[model samples]
Target: MGAVTMGCGDSCPLVRAKVREEWNIPDPKDLPDDDFRKIRDLIEQKVTSLLAQPTG
Candidate 1:
C-alpha cells in the first residue's frame, strides 16, 4: 500500500489526526545546495499557505 494509505507505525496508530498529508518531496540530502534551496522554498510556501487557512 502507498504511504498515504498505510499507517506510520505501531506508536502512531493510537492517535488520530484531523488532517494527514503527504508532500512526496524528494530528499535533498546529497543534492547540490541550489537544488536543496529550491525544495526548501517549496516546503516553506506550502506551509505558509496551509497556515493561511481558516481553522474552525
Candidate 2:
C-alpha cells in the first residue's frame, strides 16, 4: 500500500494509519541519467526487501 502524501505533518489528511517504511528519496525528474538510475536502483532494492518479508 503505497500512498503519496504532500507532507507527514499532523494535519495532513493523506497520512495513513499503517505505514511500513518512510523513504526520503529525492525527486529524480530533473536529475541526470546516472542520478536517476541510482534512485531507480535504490527503489528496486527497497521494494525487493519489502516483498521478501512475511506478511501478517
TM-scores, all models, native as reference: 0.69, 0.68
Q: Candidate 2: which stretches are off by over 4 Å? A: 1-12, 15-17
Candidate 2 per-residue lDDT, tens place, 10-55, comes to 4445555455355667777899999999988988887788779776
Task: Give one digit per residue, the lDDT tens place, for model 1 in 1-56.
Answer: 11122323233454576665567677778889999999889888877887797876
Model 2 lDDT vs. the true structure? 0.67
lDDT of each: 0.65, 0.67
Worst 10 residues of 2 by lDDT: 3-12
Whose lDDT is greatest here? 2
Candidate 1, superposed: residue stretches over 4 Å from native = 1-15
Candidate 1's displacement at residue 16, Å, is 2.9
